[model samples]
Target: MARIRLTLLVREDWRDRYPAVLERCRQAGLVIERELAAVGAIAGSIDEGQLLALEAIEGISAIEPERLNTGLE
Candidate 1:
């Protein structure tokens, strides 16, 4: 199956609500493969519709896919 990375931008004040958001994602069939709290970024791969479900969350500042690396590092 094709996979696409999903990133969610959250505010520092809403950090405590991360669990609820994660649960919502789980119910929507989106598995959170990785999470970075310092930067308030959540990375994961899910189906198209599942990804769209994230928009329902109130505190979500932004959501998008991570850019592919060109391996120049």
Candidate 2:
């Protein structure tokens, strides 16, 4: 399946374990692009079919699929 961009929300309680969480995400096949640590977010791309593996990581609270920017209110 095609790969898609995604934003991962890190659980508040899991912030302290950010490094480990990132490692797990890599293992799940995420091509990490940015680490918004201050906001508890991680931006990356992963195979559409591998989304479940990314979501199953222990510290992730939510997964947001990338959306096109239409530049409209």
lDDT of each: 0.74, 0.93
**TM-score against native, each model:** 0.73, 0.92
> Which consecutive 10 residues in model 1 have the weakest lDDT in total?
20-29
Clashing pairs in 1: none
| TM-score of candidate 1 relative to the true fold | 0.73
| Model 2 residue 69 CA deviation in Å | 1.5
lDDT of 2 at 6: 91
Q: List model 1 lDDT by residue over 1-73, tens digit each.
A: 4556788877677778877676776676677888877677777777875666778776677888878789997
> Which candidate achieves the best TM-score against the true structure?
2
